[model samples]
Target: MSERVVNPTGRGFLLLDSHPAGCFATVARMRAEAGGDAAGPGKGPVALVVGSSAGYGLAATIVGLARHGIRGVGIGFERPAGRRTATAGWYRTIATASMVAEAGGDFTFVNGDAFAEATKAEVLDLIAERFGGVDHLVYSVAAPRRTDPATGVTHQSVIKPLGAAHRTRSMEFDADGTAALREVIAEPASEAEAEATVRVMGGDDWALWIGALAERGLVNDGFRTVALSYIGSALTAAIYRDGSIGAAKAHLEATAAGLTDRLAPWSGQAFTSVNGVAVTQASTAIPGLALYVGLLRAVLGDRMQSPVEQSVQLWEQLTGARPLDLDEQGRIRLDRWELDPAVQAAVTERWEAVTSATIGEHADVEWFRTQFRSLYGFDVPDVDYTEPVETDLPWPT
Candidate 1:
């Protein structure tokens, strides 16, 4: 394969291309850190992770293979247009499949819209033919829109607040690595808009997946399910915790209870994991979150947890290797350290005093940039970006 210099396209939270070598390196690093805790070959649980292309989904998949030797089925929506580069998630998947093969674990990737009924059916068929049943299902889908299969209605989620227009401090990063801080105002969502957000982002699809799996008798006894979520502190609460997306998250967490009852027949359980903050594609798109994460990393220092680290802990709880840390609402609180009182206090102090001119003094801008770029395989360590690399790598079957 001829080498090509793959620079990241788009700017300020928008990425259009990915580096294959860098994406592979990123997965390899995460797998190594997760450690080979697998008891033996074929000893791990059989898992299906929706949205397993990037962010928490990708991390969970890698951790499952490296830490638990899970035979995994990953569902994601990514594109690899001919001549142009594929999405970062596609490269990540290829790398992950290689890891699974090396570790002697089974893996299958479904590349399509997870919201569609056809996609659900395909996953069910795969489980029945290959794995017999699923032991754990991780719902980590993060999409801006979803079209209901039955109604043929498309719902687009918004990031606006609920009651009133919310204003917050936000930052924008250019492709050249320069960033600027500015104030952003997000308006209140209309009734229809709020409903649409819930439809796209809430637990509806998650519930649907479980319902289908249960109906197909694809759930093993002691089956477990978890949907990823985030509950930020007061720093970006107005734009995040109280925003339209937050409403959907609340619905997601509430669905866990009903789902537990559905899985009760198999003695199965369902939970919502409130994950810690890290630079992800979704997080970078939210207003003020980029800055908040930057400040959080600066204040927390080594206390900060990467998505992979959180996934490692999450599996420990799911597999009974560690105690589940639940909140009053019975949801796993992986974001506890991020929401710690001391950490919040420190972050708040920096948030208030940080200005456009002084952002570098209070925030870990370099770290934030690195994390964000690494999501698209641009700034990953040990990857020689100066060398030309193939962009037309085939997806692992």
Candidate 2:
């Protein structure tokens, strides 16, 4: 059996044997969130999910299939397993497919670049063949680069602040397996870089997907489409809420407004849901958000929610179990719990005093490390990591 080692930088692969336990743990959490007994045939709506392999996208897909009994079609970009190690998203996709099948839910997954028009066309074709039409579409894609099909120009998303360079503290693992605080200085994004970031991370592709699906007559009446966004606290606003990514998010919100008007003819509705901060691959890439998340965990503890829990809440609200509360700008407020007055007050107090010397005392750094490893199917209690396991698992064709 081969043992996996986590990269100290927290952005690389870990060698592992199998991931059955992590996969099951994800399903168990989803079932629990839905109040148990998520077993049933696909008798509800048919939903299409983009970037449906990790984080919130994966959680939403699980909820749509297990809780809502939707016939699920997932689209993702993941590399195949190689000799030394497999990408985490690839393993996650395999696990998601297995769990969906176990629940007797119809699941189809397409592994490819979701930004391309070809991939969109293929997904529409699959939906037409299998389910005839879709009632819900979830857009949760997070990529660094996108290519324009029309002009063959590629755009890359930037992670820098808008103005001057920003400095923040982030967590990193040491060679001897200890959490250490590191300083991360992110440079300001150039005008071109900011523009490219918007082009890639904005809602252009999302709008295209809806348009293509509608053109093919694959959108049901009263259909709904949702795109996820984030609005963090003032502490990280410079690098996150008001930065290049934030500009892209603004564009996404604008696109939602446009899509709502565009889809009015079909009686469809579009929404932008501002979800809470959670441990995701995409979130980890942000400059200083991890420190804030660690502090948030320390403050909120058990009160804090996972992506699966948040997704369940979103499903309930959208399905009319709860009232849909929108902000002045017509955006859903799923970040309410994260940004609770009490929670933010505590976090703000700690943020003011937190430093390299005090981070360990003031933040849940261990919890942050555990959650990050869990995303890659490591540090799971149920699985015996020493046992030999197959790396190559069959995915849906």
Which candidate achieves the best TM-score against the true structure? Answer: 1
For residues 110-193, could you state the per-residue lDDT of candidate 1 as single tens digits?
998999999999989999998999999999988899998779999999999999998898977755677779889899999999
Superposed model 1: Cα runs more than 4 Å off:
1-3, 174-176
Looking at model 2, residue 220 earns an lDDT score of: 88
Task: Compare the candidates by lDDT and give the number of the best one.
Answer: 1
Q: Provide TM-scores for the models.
A: 0.97, 0.93
Q: After superposition, how far is residue 251 of candidate 2 from its true place, in Å?
A: 0.4
Q: Each prediction's Cα lDDT score? A: 0.89, 0.81
The reply for model 2, stretches above 4 Å from the true place, is 1-39
Q: What is the Cα-based TM-score of model 1?
A: 0.97
Q: Please report, as a residue range, the 10-residue window in candidate 2 with the lowest summed lDDT.
A: 6-15
lDDT of 1 at 362: 94
